[model samples]
Target: MKDSFAQLDLTTEGFRLLFEATWIQRPAGLTATATAGEWRAVRTPDELAAWALAWSDGDEDEAALFRPELLADPATTVVAGHDPDGRVLGGAVLSESGTVTGVSNLFAAGDTDPAQVWSGCLGLIASDRPVVGYESGDDLTAALAAGFQETGPLRVWLDA
Candidate 1:
């Protein structure tokens, strides 16, 4: 079940194993310290614009998809990291607060590690709930190191 990457048959047992493998966790004692690792909005119009751009892969049209109301929703957590002095390092969007979360827009300052940023974000919301996301390349690596497991993959089609 654990090493079924090659034996993935999607059988009942395979599905069960796949389900069990997908998860996220904060390393022991590796969570936030008050406001240092807090989850909040981007804090400025410019920052929000940048975050939206990153979330949309530099597509300004897709960036426009995120409205202020949606970004500030009580349920959606679109957050950026800050030092004690409060500098905007990076941020992410963790959605579906009530159930399994989907992570996105994982960007951070070069000085900070994206995986660690994700860990702190997940700690704020993970709370023993499962977190899911579409990841590839380095993002996929970061996800795995952040305690996520490979369940499968994803695809998206543009209708416009």
Candidate 2:
């Protein structure tokens, strides 16, 4: 489970610390230029399925995580970056809350830079509210380079 505030001590409950990440935020109204790939919101179920496939690297079980019902959510948007040949190179899911948009499920494929995906996602969102998310490792580096600032720490635990 996600311990967003890093306040949970799950060890006694039989959970183990899986990983730690940082909360990241980008200021509101920041503009990003389009990158090499074309970015747009996925509108159809077919498109969403395709995006999920790309995101999971063709792993059907993993792709199933993103259901078609997500597309109907008013606050949720699935954005995909496509190359000239129409292949999905990267994507992200944007969910808007009260004052900030949450960016998640960000992924990049062959020859696609994670920074470019973040930029394209920001351009597609184009919202006045700040963007917030969490990341670790290389993704954290990419988000930082794409103009996000570290906000706080977060942790994930697994029932072991």
Candidate 3:
């Protein structure tokens, strides 16, 4: 389970901390740097499948996590960034809530600057509401560079 606020203690319940990350938030109307790739929403199942492949780096087992039903949800948008030749280079999943848009599953191809992916994603979303997400290590750095601020700590737990 995900402890978004890092306020829960579950050790006694047989849950162990799996990992920790920082919650990031980008205020409304902030612009990210432009990237050479183009970003667009995944409107079709085929596009979402392709995006899943790219996001999972061709790992079929991992790709199966993103079901096609997500596309039918008006509040969820699967975005893909492609190169000039139409090769999906990066992507993200945006889930809109009442007051904020949550970004998740952000990924990029080999050697691609994550900042580019974040920039392209922000451009494609173009939402007036704030964008929120979580990350660790290099990804967190990239998000920070893309105008996101560290809001708080988060933790993931695994049942033992």
Candidate 4:
């Protein structure tokens, strides 16, 4: 079954402060067994494909987030995580309220920290709206660390 997920929501401006105040100051080792990484917006189909491929192991549901219909939307914004070697690590997506960062994001895969991923992903999203998404564990921690307070828990049942 799918695990129950927690939603992390906050204003873009609020999150940016977290990014600038805490997240960006952290170290980024992502090379030669380093402890840093980087993120960039996925502007092309190939870029989106690479990002999605890294996150979609065998789950069609996960891959469906990369559908062309989703990608074609101007609101859609996918960000890629890569190590110094340029290997595709993972990705995050933002889109919903035309000005918020709420859609989808798979920020784990490589050695990058969830906070860093969240911070970087926000770089491309519109800053005028609020951000929201379902996350857990380190990702959840990252969101909270970014200054988001819990509204409530989100139960998500998986097909077993």
**lDDT by residue for model 2 over 1-160, one digit each (tens)?**
9998999999999999999999999998778866878899999999999999999989999999999999999999999999999999899999989888999999997778898898888888765889999999999999999889999999999999
Pairwise TM-score winner, candidates 2 and 3? 2
Residue 15, candidate 4: Cα error in Å is 35
Candidate 3's C-alpha runs over 4 A off are none
Candidate 4 regions exceeding 4 Å error are: 1-38, 57-65, 158-160
Displacement of residue 147 (Cα, Å) in model 4 is 2.1
lDDT of 4 by residue, 1-160 (tens): 2222333333432432122111211112221121246767777777766677678764657766777666677766677767888876666776666444573655666565666666566554544556666655666677676545555455443222
Alpha-carbon lDDT of model 2: 0.91
lDDT of 1: 0.60
Least accurate stretch of 10 residues (summed lDDT) in model 2?
28-37
* Structure candidate 3, residue pairs in collision: none
Reference-based TM-score of each model: 0.60, 0.94, 0.93, 0.63
lDDT of each: 0.60, 0.91, 0.91, 0.56
lDDT for residue 104 in candidate 4, whole number 0-100: 64
How many Å off is the CA of 30 in candidate 4? 26
Which TM-score value belongs to model 2?
0.94
Q: What does candidate 1's lDDT look like per residue over 1-160, in tens digits? A: 3332334444543243222222233333333333335456565567777667755557899889777776566667777766675665567887875556677667765566667676667656645566766566766777777766776544332222
In angstroms, the error of model 4 at 62 is: 5.3
